[model samples]
Each structure stands twice: as C-alpha cells, then as structure tokens.
Target: MTDTGWTTERMPDMTEKTVVVTGANSGLGYEVTRALARKGATVVMACRRTNHAKTVKGRILTEVPDATLDVRELDLADRESIRSFAENFEADYDNLHVLCNNAGVMAIPRRETEDGYEMQFGVNHLGHFALTGLLFDRLLETPGETRVVTQSSGVHERGDINFEDLHGEQEYDKWDAYAQSKLANVLFAYELDRRLDEAGIDNVLSLACHPGYASTNLQRRGPEQEGSRIRLWMMRLANAVFAQSAERGALPMLYAATGEDVMGGEYVGPGGLMNMRGLPEIQPSSDRSYDEQMADRLWEISSDLTGVTYDFAQAKAADDD
Candidate 1:
C-alpha cells in the first residue's frame, strides 16, 4: 500500500501550451486530456484505436464545450507505429509543453506484444520508452516550460528488475512481470530527471505518478490463472471500499504535470487510506529503487534493446557550453 501525502492544490494555467497524451480514449488518460484542453492547451489525444479516440473526442467536447481536442492514431506497442506517430506529430506541432506517457496494459495472461517482448513489460515500459525517445526533441523545444509525466503504479513498490529474465522468457509470472515494468517506469523517470539536471536543462521536468487503487479496467485485466469466484469476490469487495473514480485517479499525473511545488524525480501519488484515494502529494520510493548501479545497468540494457540511447553526455555538454 502507498503512504504518500499529495493533493491538487496548485494547478498552472496553460493557455498556449500544446500537450500530447497517449491512450486518451478512456479512463485516466481521457480525464487528463479533457482537463488540459479545458485549461486552453491544445490537447492531442493519441490512441491505438482512432475510432475509440474519436468517440472520446465527442464525449470530451460535450463536457468541455470548447475543448481543443485533436485525436491522433498511435500504437505504442509497435515500434513502426510509434515512429509513424512521432513523425506525423512532429510535422504538425512545433512546440509541446507536456508529453504524458500514460498508455499501458496490465498483467494479461502469458502473451507477446507486436514486438515480441512480454506484453506487460513491452507495452507498459518499453513502448513508452521508445515513444519518449522519439519525441525528445519536441519536448525540448517547449521554449519555456516542458513537463513529461510517466504514469507509474503503486505495484512498483514491490518491483525489481530481473535482468537474467527481463523479458520473462525463461519463466513468466504475470504479476511479477507487471511489477518489473512499473518499477522500470520509476527508474526511467528518475534517470530522465538526473540526465536533465546534469544537462543543465531547466523548466523541463520528468515526474513519476501513480493513481493508487483507482477503480479502472486495469484490475480486471490482471493475471487471472483460474476463474476463482473467491478471488473475484474479494477483489470486488476490496475495490468497492478502496478504489476511487477515474477523475481522482488522474490527479497525481495531472498534479505532476501542473503542480507548482513539485520537484523533478519526485514520486507522486494519492494521500489517503494507504494511497488508495485522495489528492496528489510527494511520496517516498523503496530503498532498492535508489541503486544507481541498477538504474545505470537498466539504462544501458534498455538502450541496447530499443536502440534509443538518450545521449545525455551530449546534452550536458550542450547545456554547459
């Protein structure tokens, strides 16, 4: 369970900023897109399924009245799709204030993504990894303010990367794999923040956020080995008591995107009932998560796998001289 204390007290006015949010067809992503659009940001909703994103556009306009919503086609799980989306998006927009890596899949049964990596890890971690790398320049060109928000999960609290079996190739435990991906999310955020700071880049922040136990479709898609009524009943009962609505779940990410007092690399989450529901606040990470060696190793491994090294060394030199 989470024990962080965070709430949405300070939200910035993003009148001319352009924000791109992935997986904005439903749930927390949808809420984030609408909220940003309401605040006068030209919000681009990128989803795998254009039809679904179009539907969300209609729904959001209904609520936001004059919402500036643009739905784009993107499939994060596929490298080709990611490249296409990035190229197309770049051809249109000159500067982007926010890039929300909010798309992901939960612990599905043993399966492979379009790229052959474990589904959970591939979609949840690697997919976003590539997407962010592709859009790195766009984010850097924000001129004044640029924020990248990664939607981590509380399960990251119980995550550890298994390099020996990173892809879950030897053996697969859906929950453990999911945990690893979430943990990767945090490490990726921290690593990005460190790199940015070393590069002397200011007004651009990378943050990690979790919604705690929000009542979303994520739980229903988790590892279901057998159809056990007892487990199902227990989940329903727990969810009924602990889970918050999608709006509340979207707070930590939104806070990270717009909160005035937040520092880069800080983990943000809900601040109530073991982090199940509440406003956004600063949070602590597990001790193991602070291992610089592990983070570096993971970074090297990710770069090798995705062929998308961030090249912070060059960025630092550029920032300095």
Candidate 2:
C-alpha cells in the first residue's frame, strides 16, 4: 500500500456530481453507490432488476437519509435494453460526471446473451463498450472533468483473445471466457484513454480497477449454476478464509473514480500481499493487456459487433469550435 494508505475517506466532495453505477443492487456496485451517495453525489443505480435495485436504494437511503438515488433498469445482455437505458438517462439528466462499468459475471456455464454473444464476454466487455459509446457524447459535453471507470480482475493475466474462435463454440472453458472478458475491460479502458488523448480531449478520464479477492455473490454463481455442492462449499470456504469484504474491495474503484491524483489509463487494485486484499493503489496489469495491436483489433471488432462506433472526432471538433 502507499504510505498514505488511500481509502474512500480521502474521496473529494461529490456534491452536485451525477454518477451512474451499473449493477448497483449488490456487491461492490452497491458499496460504491452508497459511498458516492454519502459523499453527496446523485447516483443513478443502473440495475437489471428495478425492484431489487429499489430495495437496495432504500437500504442506502436508510443509511444516508439525504442520499439522492435513481434506480433505472439496465440489462447489459440485451442491446435494446442498453439503448433504452441511455435514452431514458438522457431524458432525465443533463450531465453525467462518472460512469462506473462495474457489474460483471464470473465463471458460469456456457451460455449466450440476447445477441448470441458468449454471456461472459458479452456482458462484461461488449455491453460496457456499447454503453460507453452510446453515452460518451454527454461525457464530452459535460462541464468540468468526467470519468469512465471499468472493473477488471487479476485472472485477466491468463486471458488470450481467440480471434478465430471468439465464442468458444468448438471448445468451451468457463474460466477462460471470464478471463478474456476481464482482460477486455482493461484493454478497453487503456484504449479509450489513448483515443481521448489522440483526439485532444482532456476533460474525460478512463481507468480500470480490480477488487482483489472480495467476498461477493459472484464467486458462488458459477458453482450454484453448475449444481456442484462440492465446488460451492469450496468457494464458500475460500471466501471465509481469504476474501475481503465487498466494502473493502470497492475502495480501489472508488479511488479510481474520485481520487485527486488518479490518472487515465492507470489500473488500480489492492496493495496487500499478492495484491489479494488491502488498500487501493496503482498497479501494473499483465503484458498482454498493454498490447496496442490487440487493443486496436478488439476495439474494431467490438464496434462492429455492437454497432456503436465512437465519434471522438466530433467531440474534438466541438472543442475546436
């Protein structure tokens, strides 16, 4: 950890800021929403289930009675849902200060999303990719600094983008799919920063962060989906023994989103033993994640697949004017 041991307490005042957190009903997202709200930010809880998110919002309101929260339905698996959410958000809010692409699934059984893409890759990477593209205009036009923070994982070190068999139709491995998706998150974050710089746009920052080994419902989903009692027990034991609480795990993301010294393209995570649990700090990602060639290829393919190409030139032109 850094000498100062950065924590959420160090976050700047967020009064008047509007933040959107995907999957805000549970785990790290929930913790992030609560913390941002406590700091006086208006948080839009972009969740898949409106009812559950409203309940979570109530929980937050109980803790921070004056917190401002807006629960909106967002299903990352479906492109239509994403578009609708963006449209509704544009109608409801004039400015967006932060977009936290934090919701994700872990190692689960092979499945396809509404658009037929692999579920893990679709929701974790492409979904966020499309969402960011759709709402990037607001980020550019909004006054003052803005941020796009993506959540990745340490397992991303083992990921390889299989261009030939992107969906793993021939050979499927759940962990491999999850790793690929997480890696894509980091790549997208870095590539976005590069594009912003290239376009001479400095008002928006893009970053990626990971919650070391936070104990959350994500780890249990795969085992439960597989109906393996032994695996579920093992996961539970690991969480009990080694994992940190979701609140602690969320610090890295919160720091990335609100830290005064945070920079675009940095990857933040725990600074404890083996980067498993501790205070948030800037860290290096895997060598593969820094490959410009791979990132460019992924960016092109993602835009083609999602049909949501970024219009950075337009933002630059507006700034020039």
Candidate 3:
C-alpha cells in the first residue's frame, strides 16, 4: 500500500488510540489536537502554559462536543520541566499511540534556554528528543501500531549543523539556528526509523512532517514584533495571498500521524510553491538531511547534550535475541 497523497479518508481508526500533541494551544497544534479529539482519540495537549491550554481545551470540546482532551504543563526549554511532564504522563496513560513532537521556537532574539543551549535547538529538537525517549516504552506496548511524528520546516533547506558551535557559542544567526533545529528534527526521525527497522519492529514508525506557509501565530514571535514592522506588514499581505488556513497548514502533520501506509522517515509537506502552501504532499528530504555520518554524530551529540542516551545498536542486538 502506498500513501502517495493526503486526505482524511485513509485516517486510521482512532477509537482506541491515544495521541500526545505538544504546544496544542494554538495554530497547527491546536487544529491537529481538535481534529484528533473529534475523531475520538484521547489527546494530551502538552503545553508550557496551562492557562492558555485550558482555553484551547474548552474551545476544542465546545466545537467537538465529545472530544476527550487533557492538559499537561511542559516547558520545553527546561529539562526539569520536561522530565516532570514525562513522569506525569507515564503515570496517567497506559498506552500512548502517537506522539506529535510539534512545539517549537522560531527566530526569537538570542536568548538561552534554562539549560544554556540555543532556544531553538533546545526546545524544537532536544525537548522532543527527550520526550520521545521517555515515552518510548508506552508506545512500544501498544497493540500493533504506533508512531512518533516530528515536525520540521522548509527552512531546513538552508540548514547546516556546525558541530564546532552546536550551542551557537561563537556566532548566532536566528534563521540559521532555527533551520538547524528543523534539520535536527528530520535527522532524529530518520535515525529512529533506521533503528526501528534494524530492530525488526514493524509496529513502530518514526516520521517527519511540515506545516508549510500557514497563516498561524507561529510567526507572532518574529513578524509581530515592533522592530519587524516591515516584515509584519509583509506577513499580513503574504498571509492573505500565499498562506493557507491553520486547518490546512496542519494537514501534513495529520496525514503523517494517521495515514495508512505511512513509511518510516517519510517527509510530508505542502506541495505548492517552494512547499510554502498547498495540500499535503509526500516530499523528498534534503540531501543534507540524509547524511548518515552526520546523523550518527548528531544522535550521539544529542544523547550527550540531553543526557538521555539509548544505544539503538544495542537495542537491535537485544531484539535479535
């Protein structure tokens, strides 16, 4: 079976699936959460702000009267917070079927997270990295199917990871840093897929997706700024003309998360105009994104950086037993 395209028709039955979506209070996250809840999937809206998440949960249940949603606090920039959220989730849920690693930070002024790492890499990449590792057991315990869908972005086309300056210690370019984080997302997903395949585990799939140029609050941190007034004006025009709705922007993720025949490490995104806006389309990963040497190095570095190391090779060997 080939998942060559996107639509809700191929959506897997969600009656018994439990989905966990980070940053589900708004934009793509909110829409995905709403749709999943409407499909009768129990969704855990893991967010940094519980207050705002409360509002979003209410809004979703109001529209999806029977939606099952739960709110959990998670500040991705803080490792302690990430740990706390994971522990709580483990205790609360018996099975976690899908994990949408979608929360992200984009091009904010040079600010370090609590762990003294670049905010984008920390939150967008490391946070999800840790979360997924913590929840690996629950996902594996599921009946026959499970997935961890990581979200990347088109900006990854311009990304290159500098091992010399992983923390952006010497120089900092917000856009570059952001791209690196997105690239890391793809790398992480691909590496996990390779591991799962080597372990001969067809029950799990690790995938990546992008929202394209969606008209969402994802840019509120950048274009919505006072200093970026010109960009702000341009955003209004671009959003009106080029961007799709939050619902449409979320389709790639929805498809990746729920579609049948979803191959591990497959990249999904909008097909129109530089992949900025359009319906969900299966796409090719960047050449740079397929560098196994770099990905292996990144896997090691990420484990070192996050202090949540797991040897996929060893796991595969154990699975062979």
Candidate 4:
C-alpha cells in the first residue's frame, strides 16, 4: 500500500484497539479522538482540565452513541501529573495500540512549568517525551504493531534548538520558543524511530505529522492567557480566513495513526500548496529537522531534565524472550 490517494475512509477496522490522545479536549486532538472512537477503538482523552475533557467526551458520545471513550486528566505542564496519568493508565489497561502526542501550547508569553522549565518547550516537547517513555512498555508489549504519533508544525522550519537556552533563561521571544518546541517534536519523533529500529523493535512504529494551518484554539490560548483581546481577535480572524477546519487539519495525524502505508520515521502532512490544506500524504520537513547529532543531544537533555529514559534494550530483551 502506498500513501497515494489515502483517506480516513481507507482506515482499517480498529475494534478492540486502544488509543491515548493528549490534549484531546479540543482542536485537532478532539477530531482525532472522535474519528478513532467512531472506528471502534477504545479512546482515552488525556487532558489537563477534567471538566473540559468531560464536555468533549459528552459531545463525542452524542455523535457516536456507541463510542468507547475515557477522559483522563493529564496536565503536560507538570511532570507529576504526567507520571500519575501513565501509572493509572497502565494499571487499568492491559494493552495500548496508539499513543498520540498531540497536545501543545503555542506562542504564549514567557512562563515556567511546575518543574521550572520554559512553558512552551516543557509542555510541548519534554512533557510528551516523559509520557511516552513512561508508557513505552505497554506499547511494546501490546498484541499488534503499535504507533507513537507526534505532532509537529510548519513553523518548525524556522526553529533551532539553543542548547544553552533550552529553557529561554537568557532571553525569550514567544514565537521563537514555540518554534523550537515544534522542532524538538520533529527531532524527537525521528530519533525515536531510529532508536526503535536500532533496538530491533519492529512492532512499534514512530511517526510525525503536522496540521497545515489548522483552525484551532491553540492560537487563542496564548493571547487569552496574556489577556490580550486584540491578539486573540487577530488570531481568530486569521484562522477564519486562512486556516482549514480542525477535522481536515487532523487528517495527517489520523493517517499516521491508521494508514498501513505509513512507516516509522516518515513525516506526514497536507498535500496542498506549501502543505497548507489538502489530503494527508508523505511530506518533507525542514532540512535541519533531520540532523541526527542534534536529535541525539536533545534526547539526552530531555531524559535528564524529565528524569525519564527509554530503556530500549530492556524492551528488546522482553521481545526476544
């Protein structure tokens, strides 16, 4: 099977499979959760706000009467919350087929997470890194081929990892921080795939995708948090005029999750002009995103910062036995 002419309609049956999507309360995350639930996958909506997650879950149930959904609190801005969510999930579920690292904070003003890391980099990149590491065993031990789909953005092209300023301590530009986080996401996904292959793990696939200019609340939150009405309004206007709907924006992720044609280490995005809006297909990202040395360094720093490291050797041994 090739990525050519792929659509959600071609997604195979997902009955009995389990998927976890972070930031599943709204935007692209919500759309992905809904589609997976409709396809008979047991979907867990991992989010920070319990109340908001409940509302989204209710809406999904209304749309798909039989949708199997669970709303779990997962505040990516806090490391403790990430650990707790992963522990609870593993205790309750025997297998996990998909782990979608979809939640993120956009170009918000300078802030710090509960652990004191820069907000954008902490929440968008390190947060997901920890969560994936914590639950990697479950994914590897699952019945069939499992996937880890990390979401990146087009803005990553302009991103560069400032090792000295990973936390933006010396200086901070909101957009620059956000771009770095997105680049980290892409680098992490690709490195993970390479590591998985090196460990001789064939059943687990890691991929990355971007929603080309998707209309989502990600743009509003930064301004709303800063209490800038003008910024919020501008974002809304831009979304209305230039962005595609959340459902369409979520296609690349959905395809990465369910498309048999997709492979580990591949990047998927909209097939339209400049990858802004169209069907999902295999796409190329920024040249810098493919830097193996940078990815290795980032992974090391992430493990040290988050105190969560992936032991692929152990995973491989388990598979061997």
Candidate 5:
C-alpha cells in the first residue's frame, strides 16, 4: 500500500513496455509521457491533432534522445476517431502495458461534442470509456500485469450525476458538468476494477488519479476560449499563486500508473492539504463515487451510449491462450 509520500523517482523500470497516453500534446499527459519515455517505455502520443502530437514527440525526443514515441491521431470527442485509434494500435502493437485516459476538458461554455453529448462528459468520460473498452483485449493479452490510469479531479466531491439529464439537455452549468465528468472518471475506474475482479481477471489494474491543483493550461484555456476576460485572468492569477507545476501535479498519475505498491481501484492524489499539492499518495474519493449501483448504472449507460461493451470473457480467453 503506497499510502502517502510517493514520488515518481520510485517508478519501476519500464524497459520494453508500451504505453498510450491521451492528450499527450500538453499538460499532465505530456509530463506522464515524458517520464515514461525516459524510463525506456515505448510511448504512443495519442492526440486530436497529429501535427501537435508530432511536435510534442519531437520535444520529448529532444529531452530524452533515446525515447521511443509514436504520434497518432485521436479525437476523443469523436467515437469514430477513438475506434480508429484503437484499431490502429492493435494492428501495430502486439501488447499494451498501460492506457492512460488523461485527456479532458475543464470548465467551459456548455458545448456538445460531435456525438451530441455534453463536452466535458463526452470527451473526459465517455470518450475514454469507449477507448478503454475497445483496447481492453490487448491489455489483457499482455504477458504481465497492465494498468489503466484515468484522470479524475478533487472537485468530484461536489459532483452529482443527473441520469435524467446525462447530456445536460435540460440545463447546463459549466462547473457542475466538469465536476460530474470527473466524478464519472472515478466511478468508471472503480467499477472497471470491480468488473475485472468479478471476471476473475487479475493481470489488468484500473486506477484513478488527480493532479491536485496543477498549473496547467487546462484551467486558463477553458475560460480564455469561452468565459469573460476577467475569468481568464482570475484563472491565471489563481494558478500562479496557488497551483503547483504540471510536473508536480502529474506525480499522482505517474505513481498510480507505475508504482508497484499501487493496486486496482485505488484513487491517488497529492498527499498535501486538501490533496491540493505535494507528493503522490493514495486518497479517498467521494461516497457517491463508490456507490456500486450508480457505478453499474453509469457503466450500462456508457456502454449503450458509446456502443462499446466490455467482452471480458473474450479478453480472458485471449490472455489464457
């Protein structure tokens, strides 16, 4: 149990491993990819913009000359893009060691995805949900233990899932939708762990993590693009004053993804005041996030909405073979 005070320096050697990180072009995803690549993992930078992903890959290679990276186009807002990414990955790679669902949109003007779902819930939760389901088989087929690390948020505590208005068709609040999506991230992670256990599959671990008030563009870009100038400035000021570096914020995710002491269903965050800033540690999420019934319901809804379902039996069979 890595209860508290864990750093990325303790990450196990990742030589010969393969990792896919969503939103690898910037922020926490960039840091995670860089760290893993430095540790000798073959990292795939999955982003919506292929050009941006290529540029980031170049930057990473400049930093770690020996780093192995593959730039792939992956627009989480589009289900077809998710399917294509997964299919291409499966065809190119024989095994997958980690799938980090790290891409997300924060508090912004209410917008719908190409698929017509609320932007936050669509890209942050449903998109990754569908992606993970599509790639579960490859993960299970890997020779050793694999992991799926989903990024949630501390604000999830204030979130409430309105199943009646899952898409915010009835009403919309930017913060509320963001919080709900982050909560869904946790719910999905824990529920996936449970389902994996019930299926008697032990090699794949599902984990969730938060950045803990990291100073990433995620905070500013949302408001910069949609909110008032005052809101943008406020976010920038808050980040400069209170937020930690993106590298620091990424510790929880790196720990959960590669820390040997970590287990499935664990929620990790910064082990500081209010889980806001510090080294990575195991943290508790909200009571609602642990509601088994709600988790199951969300899973069912997500599967139906995304047209993606987990075939654990098939994956397990492949693993056995």
Candidate 6:
C-alpha cells in the first residue's frame, strides 16, 4: 500500500497485538496509544507516573470503551526504573508486538539523569537504547512481525554528535543538546535495523520517525523548568503560529509502527511543507544520521554506559529452541 497520505485510519488491524508506548499519558504518545488501542491492540501505557497514566487510560477507555489498557511505571531518567519496568513487563506479557520509544525530554537546561548522563540525551536516547536492549530478546522471540519505533525530531538536521563532550559537561546549549539526542535516535534506529539484518532476523524491525512541528507539552517544559516566563511565552507563540496538533504530529510514528509497506531503517516524517506538518511519509534524515562509524561508536558507548548489551545470538538461539 502506498504511504502517500497515510494516517491512523490506514493502520492495519492490531488484534491480539500488544504495544508498549512510553510517555503514553500525553502528546504524541497519547495519540499513538489511543489509536492503537482503538484498533484492537492491548496497549501498555508506560509513563513515569503510574497515577497519571491510569488517569489517561481512563480517558482513552471513555472514548473507546473496548480499548484494553495497562498502566505501568517507566521512568526513563533512571536506570533502575527502566530495569524494573522491563522485568515486570517480561513476567506479565508473553508477546510484545510494538515498542514505541516515544517518551523524551526536550530543550531543558543542563541536568543529569540518575546515572549522571545529560538529561536530554539520557532520557531521549540512552534510556530508550537501554530499554530496547533489555527487551530485545522478547521482541525476537515474539511470533510474527514486531517493531521498535523510535521517535526523533526535525531539528536533528542541526545536530552534530560531540564525542569529545557527549554529555555537555564542557559546554551546554539546550537546543543543541536536544538536537544531538534526536540525531542519536535516528542513528540508533538505523543501526539496529542493520544489525538485525546482518543477524538474519526478519521478525523484528527497527524504524525511526519524527513528529514534524507539533504543539505539545514538550515545548513548555524547558521554560517551565527554568521559570522563564518570556521564553515560555515565545514558545507558546511559536506553537500557536507554526505547530500542528499532537494528534496530527503522531501520524508518522503510528504509520511507522503499523504501516504494512514501511521498511526497517526508513525514517518516517511529515510529507508537507518543509516537512513541518502533514501526512506521514518515508523521508530522509540528516546526512550525519547515516554515518555507520558514528552509529557503531554510539552503540558501543551506550552499551557500556547503560550496561545493557543486546545479545542477538542469544535471542536467535532462544527462538530456534
């Protein structure tokens, strides 16, 4: 099927599928969860706050009375939390059809995660990297096709991974850090697809997508944290003038997660003016995002920092058994 004007309406039937959506309580993540649940998928709403997720789940159920929803705690800023969530999820669910790495921190001031990594990169890239590795075996062992859809951003075009100071310890620019983390998202997704291909693994696909310019709570976060009223006002103005709805922005990720014609390693985004807002379509990411050497380096460093190594061989062996 052509992805010319793909939207959530074009999504395939998701009966019997189980999806995990991080940050499912709001914004693009919320839209994705609601859409998938409406399509007959049992959605695990992975949020840092369980109470809030439960509230969101209730809201979704009100709209789609038959939607199956599960609220689970997943704090991407903390390694311990990530590990706990993965362990709990593995014990409870036998199948994981789609993992939407949709949770992230945007242009926040320099901060550190529980593991002392930069806040934006930690939560946005490294955290998801670790989670995917932790759940790799489950994805591989699951029957039929499974997907790991990572959320990136359009600002990745301006990113340049600074290996010398990846954490921004030397210097920090909020927007630059955010861009770096986003570029890392695309790199990780493409690298994962290549690795899966090399291992002869066809059941699991890794794809990356961006939400163009969506008006979400993400924009208000940085200024809110810093108590910058003027900055917040500017962001609000920008959103009002240039951004699309979170529901519209979420189309790319939903398409990446469910589109039958989508291929692994493809970067899905808006097909509209300047790629800011429109229907979902396969698009090209930044040239730097395709650097094999950089991706490999990031993967290796991420495994070391997070201590979550992906054992594709073990997963393959388990599948064979």
lDDT of every model, 2 decimals: 0.83, 0.95, 0.87, 0.94, 0.92, 0.94
Q: Lowest summed-lDDT stretch of 10 residues in model 2?
A: 1-10
Model 5, span 1-321: residue lDDT tens: 334666767788899999999999999999999999989999999999889889888899899999999999999999999999999999999999999999999988888899999999999999999999999889988888999999999999999899999988889889999999999999999999999998889999999999999998798867777748998888889999999999999899899889988999999998887789989888789999999999999999999999999988877677677
Clashes of each: 4, 0, 1, 0, 0, 0
* Model 2 lDDT, residue 195, Cα: 98
* Residues 1-321, model 1: lDDT tens digits: 443344433456778888989989888998888778778788989999899899889988888888888999888778899889999999999988889999888776777878788888888888888888888877876577688899989898889999999988899988899889999988988888888887788767998999988877666655244566676677778778878988889988999898777888888888887876787778887776677788878888877777776766665555455
Off by over 4 Å in 6: 1-3
Q: Quick one: best TM-score, which candidate? A: 2
Ranking by lDDT: 2, 4, 6, 5, 3, 1
Worst 10-residue lDDT window for candidate 1 reads 1-10
Evaluated against the true structure, the overall lDDT of model 1 is: 0.83
- TM-score to true structure, per model: 0.92, 0.99, 0.94, 0.98, 0.97, 0.98
Model 6 quality (TM-score): 0.98
State the lDDT of candidate 2 residue by residue for 1-321, as single tens digits: 452398877899999999999999999999999999999999999999899999999999999999999999999999999999999999888999999999999999999999999999999999999999999988988899999999999999999899888887988999999999999999999999999999999999999999999999999999999999999999999999999999999999999999999999999999997998999999999999999999999999999999999988988999778
Q: List the residue pairs that clash in candidate 4.
A: none
Candidate 6: C-alpha lDDT: 0.94
Better of 2 and 3 by TM-score: 2
lDDT of 6 at 240: 98
lDDT tens string, model 6, 76-170? 99999999999999999999999999999999989999999999999999999999999987898788999999999999999989999999999
Of 1 and 2, which scores higher on lDDT?
Answer: 2
- In Å, residue 99's CA in model 4 sits off its true spot by 0.4
- For candidate 3, write residues 129-192 as lDDT tens digits: 9889878877877767889999999888889988999878899888899999999999999999
**Candidate 6, 182: how far from true, in Å?**
0.4
